[model samples]
Target chain A: MNATLTLTKLDVLRVRRNTRYLILAIAMPAVLYIAVGNSTKQTSGVEFKAYYMLAMATYGAFAGALMNNAARISTERKTGWTRQLQLTPLPGGGYVFSKIVASLVTTIPSVVVVFVLGGTVFHVHMDAWKWVVIALVLWLTSMVFVSLAVAIGYRFDPDATQPAVMLVFFPMAILGGLWFPLEGTLEKIGKWFPTYQAHKLGTDIISTGRISMESVGIIAGWAVVFAALAVVSYRSAQEQ
Target chain B: MSPDTRTPNGAVVEFENVSKTFASPKGPVHAVNGLSMSMQAGQTIAFLGPNGAGKSTSLNMLLGLSRPDSGRVALFGGSASDAIKRGMVGAMLQSGGLMSEVTVREQVQLWAKLHPRPIPVAEALKRANIADLADRRVDKLSGGQQQRVQFAMAIIGDSPLIVLDEPTTGMDVENRQAFWATMRERALEGKTVLFATHYLDEADQFAERVIVINKGRLLADGTAAQIKASAGAKRLSFRLPGVADADLYRLPNLVHVERQADVVRLQTSDSDATLYALLDAGYRPADIEIQALGLEQAFLAITAEDNNHGAGAGAGTGIGNLEAAR
Candidate 1:
């Protein structure tokens, strides 16, 4: 347990230093929110700033969570870091466990940066309890992408992981109304995506002060599927 | 433990009839073939082999990173992973990767924390001669410096069994000396050190025992001097300008003879007898030099002899000849 935690600590430290992750997960979202978050217009029965706050937070959280961990895992596997760790006293699952824990920790800054920007710069006001619940929900749902990242990372080599991540994630982001709220046929089709559902969970909380179980169910379903995929790929990769 | 460290020694490592095969485009490749060896506690053994000689495959199985198709690999009387978990084995692999962003101190410290009974991180750093580079990011360092960091990580645990695969691959001369000095200290402290190296001189100088493998089989196992002796160990060379090729060929104990211009070179099992035979012929060879052939020549001679004898049997693999890796 101590060894696992020590590895997790080092992993988290390295994640903090990763510039690309910071730019994708924290900087990009913060910039997007500042550019279009404030207006007299309302979105989903709330101020545009408040709605966009949740969108960017969700975007940042999942983006950082996926991009940071997936690339690192692929590169580490290619470089034999995973093989090196096998020689240590660390348990068989410790390396992946630490990576997951580090993702959970590092993705926080992405969510928090966008949240703080929304509150301070764009003046998105809400009850303290609402803020806490929304942040927690956004944080928890991002694990869906974290698991997807692991599955993709383990399935592909380092060279292929970059394009794989972009191809799968960019569409999910665009179709999910994360860049802007969706309506009509787009919104209806987008609702099936985990990213869309994750964003809806946040918006549902803000608009109605209560969350929909359907959105929760869709996100949770993807989480389970991806986590299973992660385990299978990780095991098969080790065999190679 | 200290008293029992010397021979009549307990076995620190045991590999009994192990074999592994990998399926390649060319069909099943025998990476290791019914190989067997054992190491006594407290021996500094060098594993010498030509490329594709199953050195890495054997090490991987011994460290429990991979499984063998048959037979067994044991460390400290148990499974390799158990021994490793008990803080009994420390290893540095040629293919192992270091964490990219961490400083040397943090990386070594993390290793220290991973082991159940690690030596102090500072002590490990000093022993590896990388204390000055402690603040530098590990990936930012040169290849040699990164190798030192790997060295520090390996020794931080202070395990009784130290396994290094090509440990000095990128090190410069000065650091290589320091690395060996530290390894010698560990050997003196009764640790079992098994290392694989491409540099035969390192095997010649540092290993008390050398095990040479070719085509996934043990070719020779002995002290460096003993192996050298078995390979017609010395080169007797001189500028005997007027000497005929026939006259040089008649030198007693000559295993091979070659000439460059007026200079003559002879590989001989007994340098003294060969020199006497030359002198008795009344040819005073000028600037005569009888240099003992180093492990490189000895290793080549051993492997080349094995490949020739087995050529008919092992040619189907398309990798019949040993690479004699430089």
Candidate 2:
């Protein structure tokens, strides 16, 4: 097998082995959608089920990607497996890119599981394009989480990875209004967050049926910033 | 084993006046300084050094993990990185390099994937004597078992050069013996092997050429017999009822003499001549035993001299003086 496929297989196996992480990533969003989102009838001229389905899917994507990728990197770093890989024929760029792809792939199940729960259990109605857009938006915006995970994996020690991830993921989810629609001070604060902008891109597709260029730009800007940080962190870690 | 005396024909690995220094809170630590050596293809060399002797640093430089502050290191007639990129060198570092989550089979397979041409995973596992444990999780394996898994990973690529830093650190007596048995087979297959080890016996028994380093300095580089010969003395211990230490020192070829209780010990360049002279002088010695010093004693003497010389010069002393001794 090729290096890319082989590495992806290894990572996918790891993801499959850690079923607890997958359950947590998938279940939290679904439970939040059912309990908090089930009672609501409508929001901003959109059905509550549809609006919050995007919210739950956004939360699941970000959580799943960061949880698995960042944790895996931290474990690899602690074990010095990354250093071992450096001595191999695999190029550094290929290792990083493979890891990114692997992490993205691992999180795909979370988006799918949550969306399926939304459509089947919550009985949300949407056009096929709407489903495609929400999935695409969730996947694309989750790149920010991938870069963030890479940075965290390099910067933090293994013992601190879980708490550090929790510290970042929970705050980002809450601030982005992924649990419910933001209003007043929460909305004002949430508007500045990259997650909020990303989540907004998904919800706007349903509420207005129109793409938001400003939100896309904001998400892209955040991704660029995090990607730069990831590079810097990875380099500095290698020096140690 | 006798020194092969066949110098490796092609230089597969070379270090040219390499120097590296690290900054610590106390001051700058010169880890390796102006070191030069080369390994010929098919040569199994043991790189021996005391703790903090810069063996790992030298190996790291040769492996391309760290760049030297000065000089150059080449593998397979090119840069170390290029050789590694070509999959010509396989290395097993001291520790912290194995992943704990995967099964032994998966770990080895993962490493195999990194190389352009890797040996069959089953072949590597069997060679390392871990075929039975291939399905076991790495975290569940013992330290020795994990080491074999690492060994499997290192040789999985069928690389021409294999470098191991203290490969037997955690292995038991039987395991270490088995490990060298595998290594000997590799050496017979014409693989150039370099390993750093604290076991002098391993160097004496396995390595055709031994390189000794102390405090970032190359102390000695030769076969084991040559190293022992360079110490230039044999120890002759005997019970001489009435012999004075002064009389023993006065004998020709005797370098030093000591008396403890009723026994006298002689350090001599020529044990035969010294014994003949002592017997001729009418010294009736009992329980006499002449011993040629081994590599361990030679290594201690060499490093001891370094310590004494380094003490007077303080911390800034480089490997300049030791090169003459080699």
Best by lDDT: 1
lDDT of 1 by residue, A1-240 (tens): 999999999999998897877788889999989998878788877888887888899899988888878898999999988888888899888998898888889888888898999889987777889888988888888888888889999999999999999998988998898898888999888998998988888777777888898988888888899999999998898887
| TM-scores of the models, in the order given | 0.92, 0.89
Looking at model 2 chain B, report the run of 10 residues with the lowest lDDT sum: B316-325
Candidate 2 wrong stretches, greater than 4 Å: B1-9, B239-286, B312-326
Q: Which candidate leads in DockQ? A: 1
- Residue B85 in model 2: lDDT: 79
Provide backbone clash counts, one per model: 0, 0
Give a tens-digit lDDT track for model 2, residues A148-208: 9999988888889899999988888888988767799988877877889877877788778
lDDT of each: 0.87, 0.81
Writing each residue's lDDT as its tens digit, candidate 1 over B163-216 gives 999999899999999999999999999889999998889999999999988777
